[model samples]
Target: MTIVLGFEGSANKIGVGIIQDGKVLSNPRRTYITPPGQGFMPSDTARHHRSCILDVLQEALEEAQIKPQDVNCVAYTKGPGMGAPLLSVAIVARTVSQLWKKPLLGVNHCIGHIEMGRLITGAENPTVLYVSGGNTQVISYSEHRYRIFGETIDIAVGNCLDRFARVLKISNDPSPGYNIEQMAKKGKKFVELPYTVKGMDVSFSGILSYIENSVEPNMLQEGQFSCLIDRLLLGGQETLFSMLVEITERAMAHCGSQEVLIVGGVGCNVRLQEMMAVMCKERGAKLFATDERFCIDNGAMIAQAGWEMFRSGQVTQLEDSWITQRYRTDEVEVTWRD
Candidate 1:
C-alpha cells in the first residue's frame, strides 16, 4: 500500500491532498480571489498560498487520518503555472519530503488532471480535452506520451471567459468563470462574435478582443446597455465553447476514440459539458466528466498522478527537484499507462 501526500499551488489555488493506492483519502484547498475587473498577480497569489498552505496541509492530513510516517512519498505540481506560485508549493513539498524522509515526485500539472479524471470517471484510453485558466488542449495517449492533437494559438478558453468577466465588472469571489456561467444562463439572445477555429486548433484572443472593442464606454456606465451585456456574455460563451467542441470532435475523429474525458478547472462548466455531450452522442461516443471536486485544480490530482509515477519507479532526486513554468503535457512519459 503506497500513500502519497500531494501539494498543488499552480495558479490562484493552494491545495493539499492524500491518496492511498487508487483511493483519495482527503483533498483540501484555498483560493486567492481578486476583486472585480482584476486578475491575480503571481506574487500576490504566491503570498496567499504561502499564508494558507500549512493550514490546508494540516487539514488534509487530519481528514485523511494519516501521519507523516505513514506516507510513502510526497508529490507536488512541478510546472505549467505561474512562477511564484509554483515555486511556493515546490518549496513546501521539498521541505515536507525532507522532514518526512520520503521519496519525492514532481508531477506535471496537466497529467495530474488527466490521471485524476480517469481515476474518478473510470474512463480508459479516452481522448481528453484539457481546458483551464492557463491551458487549452485536446490530447490523446500515444506511444508512452499524452500527445496533443489540438491547442489554443493564443489565450486559453478559461482565461478568455475570466477576462470578459472582468470587463463586465463581475464578482471574482467564487470565480470569474462561474459568475460568467451564471450570467450566460439568463441570456435569451446570441450576438455574433468571432469564431476562430483553424483546422484542429482554436483561438480565443480574437474573440476576446472583438468583445472588448464592442463594449463601448457607454456600456460601462451603470444601468446602461444591460440587455446588450447579457447577450455579449452569453454569445461569447457559446462561441468559445463551440470552438472548443469543434476541435475536440476533430481530435476524436482523427484518433478514432469512442470516449471523451474533460479535465482541468474549466471542465466544471455545465454548458461545456453539455455541448461535449451532444457532440459525443452524435459521434456515438461516451462523455465522461467530474464535478468541481475533481474538475477544478486540487491536490488529489497531484497525489493520484504521483501515486502512479511512484508505483512505476519514478522519483525525483532532491538536487534535481526543481520547478518549471512552461512544462508541456507531451514532455512527460506516461510510464504508468500501457
Candidate 2:
C-alpha cells in the first residue's frame, strides 16, 4: 500500500491529508476567515496558513495513525492559486519531503478536485462542472487531458457571490457564499440580472457591477431592504445556476456523456445541486456531486491525485518545485487514467 501525504494551501485554507493506495486515511483542514465586509488578502492568508500548517499536518498524521516515515511520497498543490499561499504550502511540503526522505509530487489544484470528485462519486467519464472562487470550467476527459469546453471569461461564480456578500456586509465565518445561500432561501420574487453566456464562456463581473451600482442602492432608497436583497440573492442564484446547467448540458451533449459531475467550492450549494438535478432528470442524465467536505478545497483531493501520479512514476525534483498562479486544467497530462 503506497502511502502519500498531501498539503493543500492554495488559497485561504491550510489542509493536510493522508491516503494509502487510493483510500483516504485522513483529511484535516482549516480556513482563514476575515471580518464582515472584508476579503482575504493574499499575504495575510499566507501567514495564516504558515501558522496553522504544522498543527494541521500533525492532526492529519495523528488521525491517520501513521508516522512520517510511513509516507512513501509527499504531495502539494503546485499551481492555479494565489501565489503567496501556494508558496507558503510548497515551502512546508519541501521541508517535510527533505526531512522524511520521501519523493515529492506536484499536484495540479483543478485536477485534484476533479479526481477526488470522481473517486468519491464513482462517476466514470463524466462531464465535469468545476466552479470555485478562483475557477469555473466545464471539462471532460479527452486525449489524455481534461479538456475545457466552457469556462468563466471574467470573474468566477464564487468570487461574484463573495463580493456581493461583502457589499451586504455578511459574516465570513463559515463563508460569505454560504451566508448568501441561506439568505436566498427567503427570497420569493425574482429580480432581473444580466445573464452573460457568450459561446461556452460565462461572465459575472457585469452582474456584480449591476448589483452593486444599481440594484442594491435602488432597493435601499425604496425602503424595501429585506425583500429586495432576498430577491437579488435568490434571483441571482437562479439565473447563474441556470447558466451553469445550460453550459453543462451543452458540454455533455458535445462529449456524449450522460453523467455530470460537479466539483470545486461552489459545487456544494444545495440550490445548484437541485437545479442540476432537475436538468439531468429532464435530459435523462445523472448528476454527481460530493458533500461539502469533499466539494470544497481539501488536502484529500490533492493526496488522491498525487497518489495516482506517484503510482505512474511521476515525481517532482526539488529544483523544479515552483508555484504558478495560472496553471490550466488541460496543461496536466492525465497519465494515470486510461
Best lDDT among the predictions, by candidate number: 1
Best by TM-score: 1
Model 1 residue runs over 4 Å out of place are none
lDDT of each: 0.93, 0.91
Off by over 4 Å in 2: 215-223
Clashes within 3 Å, all models in order: 0, 0
Tens digit per residue, CA lDDT, model 2, 206-229: 888877875454555546767756
lDDT accuracy of residue 144 in candidate 2: 90
Backbone clashes, candidate 1: 0
Q: How does model 2 score by TM-score?
A: 0.97
**Across residues 99-181, which tens digit of lDDT does each residue of candidate 1 receive?**
98999999999999999999999999999999999999999999999999999999999899888988878899898988888
